[model samples]
Target: MLTNKGTLIPIGGNEDKGIEDNEQYTLEFIDDGILFHVVREAGGTDANIVVIPTASSIPVEVGENYLEAFSTLGCKNVTVLDIRSKEDSEKQASINLIKAANCIMFSGGDQSKITNKIGGTEIHDIIKYRYKNEKGFVVAGTSAGAMMMSQEMIAGGSATESFIKGAVKMYKGLGLVPGLIIDTHFIKRGRFGRISEAVAQFPQLIGIGLAEDTGMIIKNKRCRVIGSGMVIIFDGRRLKHNRHKILTEGTPMSLTGMRTHILSNSDSFHIEKKKVKILPIEAPFI
Candidate 1:
């Protein structure tokens, strides 16, 4: 049982961008207006936010992007931690920044890079400790960052090839949250088959698919959907299937009795109870 009192924001890739008069990005991605939400959750504008761009190939560029975004959102003490190697992750200065941060944001990129470079380092340990012990600490990540928030993560696989047994590679992640697997770029990328197969493989874990521009805000036992798109839940707890016929390489596996739920913005889901509360729709009176 994981009991982290802090908040986790896992966003799908390619969030909507706010445009300026000069046809440039306003630095606000219309991630259901989540940048503001993050500010609020991290104890308002004076919050100390450290952005980690380790997952990105172009760390400097990605780091700048977040620095600008948070700055535009009026967050005063936002800084980017340019961690390239395990040594950088272990630095006392890096660890100090994490310890002082009200929020830690992981930028989108290759999740393996994040786990390899930062995992088990002093920075990672401090993050885990603060997230569990601090009341309002926040951990936010997008795309690959979002994918690595669980105990088990999708390393790589195309949706078309995922039906084949052992096609998708699963890897150990940050383990900030347990018993869950998160997949980003869900609807736009057509990742249903990929996430479905993941659930079939590990029926005990819940499979969550986050569509682009959408995300989930998870606390201890509940998650609230945020953004314009939807959150797909593939529950395999009641699943029934025959695996003997499909264990051979290249053969497509079959699964049955898996339950699924689609949640839109403002909807809430109870993690422990596996329950969903849909927000009431608004309509004009006749």
Candidate 2:
């Protein structure tokens, strides 16, 4: 099933769930994509990694900061592409970066900007193609960067704000992972309500609320929590609602008998099964 918003509707079926129990989707979530996370994992070995910093709202310095961080990852050869500029120079640079990288990281910023800038661009297509061909490429993001991984993004704000109708105003995401709605800065920003609203709008989709400094490593349809925060899984597959007239914003709309699971770092959750496989800890690694 697919949502009206163009996101994959979470359905109960073999195909709907990415979990096969035997296979795992291998992905790494780093603080950023290059120097901090991917490079460290590389351990001085040369590996392809792409960095998308559109969410950073600044220029990514490849030689200055990125190189230094990448060295720690033991990467001898590194290429950094700053897609934020999207100028002719940057576009060409982005093409080269995507073509060479084994892993792609999307930085935190306004998701709308990131998607608009690179969604359908050549860079995006190249990365997708490479990843699909089993180049051992891992894609990751933080905050807004993470939001764009899902087919349906959480572009709407709180119910208190003016809602521009028409399926929550979503743009074309990178489509790295489908059928899931991802939100960042979850706990700190009190974004549960917003994700809940998204579920109400599309109950078929599983809502993943990731707290700051925390990330969910998705492999083979199952998610492993990694970071210092909590990940809230909102499963509305069994949601029930009452018909009412004249629904107003922030009127304490009641959702009777809705259940949510809170998972912390190193914990795991199954999207299709809608169940928590492990419990989270108080102290999670970054």
Candidate 3:
């Protein structure tokens, strides 16, 4: 129920940065890509955008990557907040950058690092405050950054575990969106079973599995899919039979009445309503 006024863009891993390893193609693919949408939603290229690469092990390289990507999108006012430790989150410099920014973009690496370093910090509080109260404030993240948006964060899991019990590991997140449990790299990484167990654990929350290069723009409890891949939604609230609680760890589990939705770019989903809204605004949403 912690729906906010600002926008939340949680992308699956491997988003188009518009750059290659050998400096091949730049700005050619990312024109209408995820970063373009991020810039557009953050009030365009002039918006004060701050990229936090705290989750990344190589913060400098990741930070520079975002700088170039945003630069290619015509974003003139982008800054990288290289937060490495918990102490860095409390610094006046970091707080100032967060306070002045219209959008905060989190880079992917380790989701736990974001919560460990910045969770409950001053800037974290400020972001939640602005996101809850402000209309245009944007909080966007990719991969691990995407997973940290949910209150119930997926820390780590065994992809090889299949649909077995205890395959997914979860932890506390930023609590920006309490209604969702987000997972990144769904199709490529084969995270269907991982998120399925996660939904069985917290049946009240909706499970969102975002594929590579895909993302969702969430506002006012409504989510619209973006990017090139798919977004798998698992609704477990109407579950009839759940064998997760009784099953032992590592055992295969069965869950009945777990509703699923496979949505692509331009498709829409109303979170509270649990209904899909396809393209064409003139037609019936449900």
Best by lDDT: 3
Give residue 244's lDDT in candidate 3 (0 to 100): 84
- Please give the RMSD to the true structure for each candidate, in Å: 3.5, 10.1, 3.1
lDDT of 3 at 80: 92
In model 3, where do residues sit more than 4 Å from their true spots?
16-32, 280-286
lDDT of 3 at 61: 75
User: Candidate 1's residue-wise lDDT over 73-141, tens digit each?
Assistant: 787898999999999998889988998899998888899999999888888888888888888999999
lDDT of 3 by residue, 27-104 (tens): 212544888888889999899999998888778877787788888778899999998888999999999999999999
Give lDDT per model, in order.
Answer: 0.82, 0.58, 0.87
Model 3 score (lDDT): 0.87
Candidate 2: regions farther than 4 A off? 1-45, 61-68, 85-93, 159-169, 242-252, 279-286
Of 1 and 3, the candidate ahead on lDDT is 3
Report the C-alpha displacement of residue 45, candidate 1, in angstroms. Answer: 1.1
